[model samples]
Target: MPIESPSRRHVLQASLTVASSALFARAGAQGLTGPAYEVSPWPGPLTAFSLVDTSGKTWRPADFKGRAVLLNFWASWCEPCRAEMPTLQQMADLYGPEQLLVLAINFKEAPARALQFAKRTGITLPVLLDVDGQAARRWGVKVFPTTLAIDRHGQPRLRVQGEMDWTGKAAEKLIASLL
Candidate 1:
């Protein structure tokens, strides 16, 4: 039986707008933006560790500065990891070293096994060796094929667990947004 005041209506509208924006931002950060990723908002310093590739060159998270890094922890025995290798390789080629660096870190596996898997899969991406499981422990990797998307500043941003279609449109859009 009474009309609402102008100030009250303005406040309600503003509150609704803010709420909607927050919801969308949270959803986008969580890889729910129509992408095949399972993103989680991980805004923190990356776990520190040092690992080498087949060439014996040491690598750290900080070494990937100035470019987004896709640090994937996987094992040769993981079927999902093997299944995702080609798509990962394709993504690596698409982004290249200047934009996105895809690091396929073999989890506690022998160099021979890692090399053999890469060879078999024709994976051209740079493969890092998580020898002795030190790096895996530091990164808190409990599952196979865990992919962490790190920003250019060496900060962990998004984490995608399980396998994914990295070559799909949703993935491309998400990576492009990061770039």
Candidate 2:
């Protein structure tokens, strides 16, 4: 093992700090870093739609009003979807039913399977089964773990296409902004 001298360590730390700052600054300057929502007013109340949580409680889309809601399209077949669940749980821990809503829409998965998966994995977020893929079509979801951040007015604010580091400082701040 090579030990870095005090001067070398200082230089390395300074370099790392500068690099991190530059990335953030560049992202800000580009102005295309955040998410963009293609739909507005969330279309309509999440009626005609049915979702069951681990406890068998049904959640209508309308139930998520007055708060920022996340429409997540996921499947047990997707590796990323399962891998990113912990981050989703962390977000759930941070935001309550009043501030933010995390709705996990499971695609083509049977209710029993969804419930079983949730129980085994400890995914507390309400998992709605999209048995017919109709709900996924409404959201234009082409991939697993696609997330839509909808404002209180039902307008979609951001659309993320993959697993995200939701508990990161920037993500937390962004959600806070919505709140």
**CA lDDT, every prediction?**
0.82, 0.75
Segments of candidate 1 deviating more than 4 angstroms: 1-37
Candidate 2 versus the native: TM-score?
0.69
lDDT by residue (13-102, candidate 1, tens digit) is 999999999999999887677634366665645867778897688888768879998889999888888888899889989878888999
What lDDT score is found at residue 75 in candidate 1?
95
Clashing pairs in 1: none
60-161: candidate 2 lDDT, tens digit per residue: 757867998887888888887888777888897788868888888888888888888788998888888778898888767786778777777666676667
Number of backbone-clashing residue pairs for each candidate, in the order shown: 0, 1
